[model samples]
Target chain A: MQFTCAKEDLLTAIGTVNRAASKMQKTILECILFSCGETGITLRATDIALSIKTEMNAQVEQTGDAAIPAKLLYEIIGRFPESDVTFKSVGENSMEISCLNSKVVLQQMDADEFPIFPALEDKEQIKLPQCVLRTMINQTLFAAAVNEDKPILTGLLFDIEPGSLTVVALDGYRMAVRRQAAISDIARKCVIPSRTLREVSRIISDTEENVKISISGNMALFEAGNTEIYTRLLEGEYINYKNLLPADCATSVKVETNMLKDSLERASILAREGNNNVVKFEISEKNLEITSNSEMGNIDEQIPVITEGKDLVIAFNAKYVLDVLKNVEESEVLMQYNTGVSPCVVKQENSDAYEYLILPVQLREE
Target chain B: MQFTCAKEDLLTAIGTVNRAASKMQKTILECILFSCGETGITLRATDIALSIKTEMNAQVEQTGDAAIPAKLLYEIIGRFPESDVTFKSVGENSMEISCLNSKVVLQQMDADEFPIFPALEDKEQIKLPQCVLRTMINQTLFAAAVNEDKPILTGLLFDIEPGSLTVVALDGYRMAVRRQAAISDIARKCVIPSRTLREVSRIISDTEENVKISISGNMALFEAGNTEIYTRLLEGEYINYKNLLPADCATSVKVETNMLKDSLERASILAREGNNNVVKFEISEKNLEITSNSEMGNIDEQIPVITEGKDLVIAFNAKYVLDVLKNVEESEVLMQYNTGVSPCVVKQENSDAYEYLILPVQLREE
Candidate 1:
């Protein structure tokens, strides 16, 4: 087999597919199937749970195939200067790569042992701009449960309706919900692994270009530009999170996003030393008082805010509050509290595109 | 005690002395002795082997001392916004820090238990531009022995003459020597620990400002601007590296520093897979051919060069050669070779500011 391609183009393709190949695998699963056809060169890698396939333009000399170690090939191509690199099969299990005055012969695995990329039939499809999809994933993915205690909570639920899509993720402590307008004929829902969503977000360009997502029986496919990602849908039903959001609150406050984030970040410095990382917030007339204490030190900070209704005092894990505040891009955010021990709900001041529910820690009086 | 100062100034002073305080220590050594008097605020930390003291201007309301944890103070000050910060002793073991609307009361160790800074007598002194001293240390420190197999070899030798100061470091395989002109009243020699030199290099400004270096019986003092660094000298005789340089060579090759560096970096990718990163070089009349092979792959690269005298082939540890190439800022470098087994001498093409001798690895015929 022989083909020539630009180093940059090949490197990008390898990088996208290598992410899947680098995961813990057995035998030939760790290699990427590199093949050249009449159209161009195609690279595919899979670790049984997740798979990626990408294609790039290349000048095909002879059509052939080989399974190359994904990471080694990526590293080698990255080091090459910006120039055209040519790959030619040498023997039964060797491939020769040459670029400029440099030449390398790399060992290759048998292409016959590599798994085939699964062909998918779109049972339901939804299309949205890459930028919108990226925002939805980034804002909600952080709340996904990292441990497998519930199995289903480890994945983000992608709920699709006739004209809207909402992504939701919740650990036991916090939940994030993002809603975007996307048109689809059939209503469907699927839980995608957090790892797959993260990689998809990284691979998709943050531009106005649209990415088409197709969901089938137990697999979901993401197609954008010349790359395709196929991942296994998590099994089991996700928790019903709609009933958990508080409908009304006795106290409401509006504050600048950056001001709250910065104060919480400082308060977390001391709170991080303790097991619970609890920071107390005393919301009153026109100011929010935040305080945290540990064995080593204690910190007290105050930021101005507009408050309505009755005053409230609550405590929460600083990390959860900080995470939501950081993900929120609005200049001003509105927070609602029903009681000291009830979960607090934060939303954008003027828009309802995103909502966050954070459970408060039970504060013990000293 | 009460004092107020700009957060930036306080942060910088704490950062400088905090390096020495962060090292593993016992009791109060882990804390920085923060004191305010007529000379402003003085901060000192010691790990017995190395110590640092620095001073910054502050509004001294009342003169007093407290031992503050180095890392904690640094982190807290770094998080505060740019503003005036005030510190006051709340009680016997607590220091209250206030900045803007943030207040923190940090636990402190007893100040009386902290060790006092040592007094040093300048038996011999040398003053040179901070930039020159920084360059001398940077150009040679990489060759210092990392292990304590030979206690003295782990430190860089400071050979101070009446008009020149030469810094040399060598492991068993390679040696780096840097020399610069500096006037000294009396000739002196001392082996400074690599850790001390590294910290000194980091603290010194890379400018034309002069730094006064004082060498006493057992400790060396480096005073630059408002910072003072005191370190214990390694006690032993340094290796005699002057005689180790090859007097002449049978072959000489001049190549672009970046071109050779890039070629070797690519070759090293394959060479690194083996137990020893040995890359072979064939110096002919017009080209330098480099090659390396391992179980995974083999790379062959060639770069044009001007070679005078007999042709030669040699092999070396790619890391040593790459280290020197990365350090040398010259566009072109001159490499002299005596034989395949003899040490290769690398120097600046037109200047004698730095010299590197790398021992060649024995090339066994396959």
Candidate 2:
């Protein structure tokens, strides 16, 4: 096998598949297949749960294939000069890499031992703008359960409807729901692991092109630019979170998102030291006060707000509220809730496209 | 304790003492004593090994001292607005801090429980440019022994003479010597722990002001910018490294430092996998060849060089050579060796202000 490519192009291709290869067993499993054929060079790596493959432009001298150690190949490519790097197979299972006047011979694994990448044929397909998909993933993935005790909760529910696509995730403490326009009108539902969504989103962020997703019975493939990523779907029954959200809220406060976020961040620093990072908010017609007391100290901050309905006092885990607040870019946010025992709903001032529900913690008066 | 100061000023003062307070015990030693008096505000912290203190201008309403947790104080002050912050003692062990509409009451330790910083005074002192002193420390400190197995090797020897000061450190495999003009006429010798020198260098780098060094008995103090740091000297007999350096050299090669450095870095990648990270260099009339072969692979790199004395081949730890090469800013570096078994001397082409000695490993030809 012999091929030459720009140092930067090879480096980027290696980095694209590095995450998938890192989790694979080093014995042949961690080897990335470098196939030099008619068009260019194709590289693939997999960790059973996920696989990524990328096609890069290169000058192919001889058409052949070899499996190189993913990590070592990346490190070596990273140090090559900003010129074309030539990779040529020498004797059996040995390869030589050259750039400018520098040359090195590295050992390679048997290409036969490497796993083949799956063909990403679409049984059902969905296409969306990369930026929009990435935003949807970011808004809801954080609410997914971190621990896999409940496998279903560790994934974000993809509820595809006739005209809209709704992504939702929930842990025991909070829930996040995001809705966006759908590219395809076919209605279907699937549970994709939060980790997979994060990886897909990360790949999509690198470019502004639309991502074409192909889903079969068990695996989903994401194709963006010259790269393709495949991840296994989580199989389980997801909880119906609609019943958990309260229908009526007695109190509603409209405050600038930045103002509320800043105050809560400072108050959370003190609350973080407590058993449960709970910060209490007292809302009235004119102003809102946030307070938290922990072993280290206490913080009391007040931000002006326009109130509606009834005056109320409620407490919540500062982290849950902060998570959703940071994702919001709007100027004002509406905080609506009933009695201290009900869930607090946070949404953009005039939009219902995104909703964050935080469960209130029972506060004991000292 | 009651005082008011700009948020930036207080944060800077706290940061100056943070390094010293972090090493102290958290129960009591971690507390930084905050003193508000007629003059201004004084803050101090100590870890027995090192102590730091700084004084800044602040409006004092009460003359009292309170020992506050160094980490907590810094964290809280970091979040305060850019306005003046008011700190007042509410009780014997609690203090209230307010800035704008934000307020918090934090617990403080008993002032009497905190360690008092020692007064640093010496009849003989040295004042040097912070940049020069920082450079001297960086060049020699890396050779200091990391473990205290041999306590003497852990400290860098500071040999101060009438007109010149020489600093040296050796870790069995290598030695680094740096010589510079003395800023003070009074000559005295001392051995400072490498860790102390690193900390002193770090503080010096934060400012462009001069650094004042004072040594008395077993303690040395470094005053840089607005911070004064005290450290206990490492008292012991240093190894006689002068006898280990070779006076005769049979082979020499002058090459671009950057070229040699880059080639060696790549070759070292393969060598690092072996039991010894040894890279062999062969010098000829116009070219130098570097090679390394390990279990993973082998790398051979060649670069142009100007040969002097006798052409020879030798092997040394690639890391040791890379360390000194990175410190050289000159275009070319001179590499000299007497024999394959003797130490190789590396220095700038025309300067003797700093010299690096690397011991070569006995290579067996296969």
Candidate 3:
């Protein structure tokens, strides 16, 4: 294949797709297959788990395919002269790249060795504004399980209806769920891997354009401006997170998000030394007190808050509270607790919007 | 000890000294001992390999001593309000810190359990400009051995005479040595651990004022401004780097530092796939050509330069050459080489101020 394209466009596309390429992998999986034709040149990469296919318009003189090492190709293309770069396949396993006065001959692998990506059928597709989905993913994905020990927890549950879309993630320790007005009429639910959500968020530009998403059985496809991202779904049932959240909380308090976050972070340093990074929160009629103690020492912080109901004392992993506070959108966050042993719920003061539920750690007797 | 000091000052002092604390030791060697009295507060830490002591002027109420985890103390103190913070020993193993409306009591190790650092004895000391020593250390220390397999190579060699000072470091593969005009009349030689040199560089500010450096039997002490750094000297002799550098070379070429660096960096992406990241440089009367090839591909870059010798082709580890070029001072660098297998010498074009010798890697047969 022979074609010429802008250096920056190719660099970005290659970099985005190469993220899934394993550095230690010695096979063709580390190679990004490039196809050039009269229309344009397309770059594809997959580890048999997730695949990214990107097409960039280029001046095509010949049609061919070559698989180049993802990392080397990206680096070389990034460093090439800030002008149009021409690529031409010279032999079965080599391609010539020329730009300005510099030329490089890159070794290539057989494109046929690359795994065949399933064609995304034009079935049930949901269209959503990029920014809305991006925000929802960012707000809840952090609570997803990082390891596959409990495979279902590693995926975020996407529950969609006619008017609203809800995304929930839980690692058994903490759960985050966010709801947004739906832009599509389709009603469906699927568990998309947290990693796929993160990658989709990263690859999607800040443009206001809509991203078209399609789910077929166990595979999902996301199509944006010029990029297509495909990820496989986890085959398991997600836990009923709503059942875990307390229906009636004994005490609830509204405090400034930033102030509460700062106080909790300072106490976390002490709390982190213990078995579970436990920190105690004592809520009174008009004040919220946070405390943590270890063999190193103890920290006590008090923040003025508007509170209702009886006084209560609860202990939890300080990190969990900080994470919830960090993602809260409103200036004031409302914290609700039933008993010391039950899960505590945190959300923006008066909205049924985004909510976080965190299990408390039993306080150790002094 | 009881005292109140600005949170910023306390945090800075703790951070500087915390570099000396090691987590490997079972004893609370990772803790920084704080002594607060009526005059000021002193923070000190040591792992027996290196020691750092810093004094911060504070409002002292009563004298007290406590050993707190260096990292935790720094983190906690850093988060305290920018205003003055109060410190009071709550009991034998805990200290209370109050700033703004925040109060934290840190558990401390017994002061008696902390290591007793050796006194900075008034010995034969050499005074040198802080920037000069700092630059020399940065230039050569990157070449020091990281593994303990070669003990002596892990330290930076200090060679001093009546009016000159030279620092050298090598990891058997590549060596760098920097020389400066000494401001002191004393002549001495010692080997300080590379890690200690790095820490001292971080703490020492760039100042025109001379820093007093004293060498004892097995310790090196550096006192500058308000900080005192002590490092244990490595036992055994350093390699004679002068012998490794060739006195006479068959070919020599001068090239702009940045031009060569950029070209080498571009070639590095291709070279990285090779066994040793070997990049070949062919110097002729008109140009400097850099090339690297692996199973992945090959890259050739031609940079214009002025040469005074016959055409020659030499190959060396691209990373080594990049490291040497990165630290050279002059705008133009002079490269001298005899053959493809011989060591390549790199230095400033017109001066013998700093020299680098990088062993060439043997070229694989095509």
Residue A95 accuracy (lDDT) in model 2:
92
lDDT of 1 by residue, B106-204 (tens): 999889988878788755899899999999999999999999899899999999998889999999999999989986866888999999999999999
Q: Would candidate 1 be rated incorrect, acceptable, medium or high by CAPRI criteria?
A: high
Q: All candidates' lDDT scores?
A: 0.91, 0.85, 0.85
Ordered list by TM-score, greatest first: 1, 2, 3
Q: Could you tell me how far off, in angstroms, the CA of residue B252 lies in candidate 2 after the best superposition? A: 2.2
lDDT of 3 by residue, A226-260 (tens): 89999998888888777877779788888899888
Q: Which clashing pairs does model 3 show?
A: A296-B107, A297-B107, B1-B64
Candidate ordering by DockQ (highest first): 1, 3, 2
TM-score each candidate: 0.98, 0.95, 0.95
Q: Candidate 1: global Cα-lDDT?
A: 0.91
Cα lDDT, model 1, residue A285: 88
Measured with DockQ on alpha carbons, how good is candidate 1?
Answer: 0.81
Q: What local lDDT score does residue A260 receive in model 1, on the 0 to 100 scale?
A: 89
Residue A173, model 2: Cα distance from true site in angstroms? 1.7
Task: Tell me, by lDDT, which candidate is best.
Answer: 1
lDDT of 1 at A99: 94
Q: Any idea how many clashes model 2 has?
A: 0
Model 2 lDDT per residue over A1-366, tens place: 898889999999988887788544447778788888987999988877889999999989899988888887788778877999999999888999999868989888889877877775556777778998999999899999999789989999988777677899999889998988867767778889887898788778745578877778888888899989988889988887678667887999999898788888888878988547899999899899999998877889988999998888888889999998998878898989889888999987778788899999998977
Best by TM-score: 1
lDDT of 2 at B301: 90
